[model samples]
Target: MIIDIIGDIHGYADKLIGLLTQLGYQHNGQCFMPPKGHRALFIGDLIDRGPQQIKTLDIVFAMLDADVADAVMGNHEYNALAFATLDPEHAENYLREHNETHTRQHEAFLAEVPFGSERHHYWLKRFCEIPLWLETDSACFVHACWDVDSMAILKPLLTRDNCLTPQALTLTSKKHTPMFDALERVLKGVETPLPKGIVMVDKEGTTRSRVRVRWWLDDLDNRPIREIARAPHSAIAQIPLDTKAEPIDFTLKTDKPIFVGHYWLTGTPTPLSTQVVCTDYSAAVDSGYLTCYQLDTECPLPLSPNNFVQYRHT
Candidate 1:
């Protein structure tokens, strides 16, 4: 079977439809289907940060329901669930505090589906059903990093079908817990503390002291800070090499291919490594493109730009 590994679609239904069409998927009233027995494997982040949130969800949901596609849960989906759920300890508060920052991050989604509406609750139930990752005989897929150790720690905690249960979500939501750390590493990627008194503004204009590291790299001890960052910044290269920071050991080696989408990358899409591919090309932004990787089951995965397909937003 040929699999189309798709990137994050942050409410850009038009681009998604365009990409599906480009991949020879025809709409059969309810959902798109490929003619040659191909399937779409979505990397999640299906909602938020765009104009058509509910429409996007409908398409993705229909595809999944029709057995045309499978998806992993993105951090946005996790946060959405937490935001909608009331904290058991504090009846008035949400699992994820409903502060300005949290609300703003989810504003687009909430605008389309009101917080307590029937539609909101329906989707929340579906969101919780999404698995954090998918592993097959030949490949693995996740929203972010596939840290072996982290997944090992999370394996026993997951439900029989490899999904996070309500109790698991609550446990992972707590600060400094092993579950929290493992979930963070898998969903958000590995992060490293910046030098003393150093902070950088993220895409949301929030200043953060910790930056997501390039977890695919196994040897970070000798690498420069700029080289170790997944989202490199001009200021990061200026940080002193002697600055103390925690060491990251990404020692997961596998022959099977791995696909992920979360980092808002731009430019022409390509395989991250011989066996690793990141299809997210900042599709939520005006200048970004919706990207995908076409994988053939008969052959071993190739690290080339030729397999990358995209639909540019116009």
Candidate 2:
């Protein structure tokens, strides 16, 4: 089968339409359908961070309903569910606290869906239906890191379709639990603690003590922090190489290709490794592009830059 593994749309409908058209998918009044029996595999984050959130949802859900696409839930979708769901234990509070930080992160989505509208609740339920990962004989797909240990821990908790059950969702929301940790690693990727007393401001201007690591690489402990980090800022390079942080051992070697999105990578799209490809190019940003990897079951999994198709947001 020919699968177009697409990255985070983040509510960019025009770009999504353009990319679909570029990939030879024609809108048949209700949903977009690809020629030549191609299918789109979305790596979630369908809402938030851009204009036209409802339109984005309309297109993606239409495709899904039409059996033209499959998807895994992204962190943004998970967060939306948490923010809207009330805590069973503490009935007054939500699963995710509605503070300034969380609100800011969700503002774009709320602007379109509102807080407690029917549309918001409807999408929340739809988010729950999305699986956390996908696997086939030829390849694997996840929104972020595919840590073997985390997947093992999560497998029993998921439904037959690989989605989190209501019970699993409640359990995973608690901090410092095994379920929480596993969910974090899969949806958000692995992070390493910065050198003692070191802190860096992220792109969002939030000071963070941990830095996102390139968990797919081997020998991460021996590598310098700057080289293995997914988005190493200038301030991080200044941290001494001998800072003595233990390497996180999350790499899962596999023969099949793995595709993921959520890192918000920039520049020309390319494979992260021979077996791993990241299609996200920060599509919600002004200079970002909605990226997709064209995969053919007949071909080997090692991706080429030529297979990447994108529609840059002007």
In model 1, the runs with Cα more than 4 Å from the true position are 232-245
Error of model 1, residue 65, in angstroms: 0.7
Worst 10-residue lDDT window, candidate 1: 232-241
Best model number under lDDT? 2
Cα RMSD, each candidate: 1.6, 1.5
Best-fitting candidate, scored by TM-score: 2
Give the TM-score comparing model 2 with the true structure, all chains together: 0.96
Q: Candidate 2: misplaced stretches above 4 Å? A: 232-238, 241-244
In model 2, what is the error at residue 188, expressed in angstroms? Answer: 0.5
lDDT of each: 0.85, 0.87
C-alpha TM-score for every candidate: 0.95, 0.96
lDDT of 1 by residue, 8-47 (tens): 9999899999999999999999899876768999998999
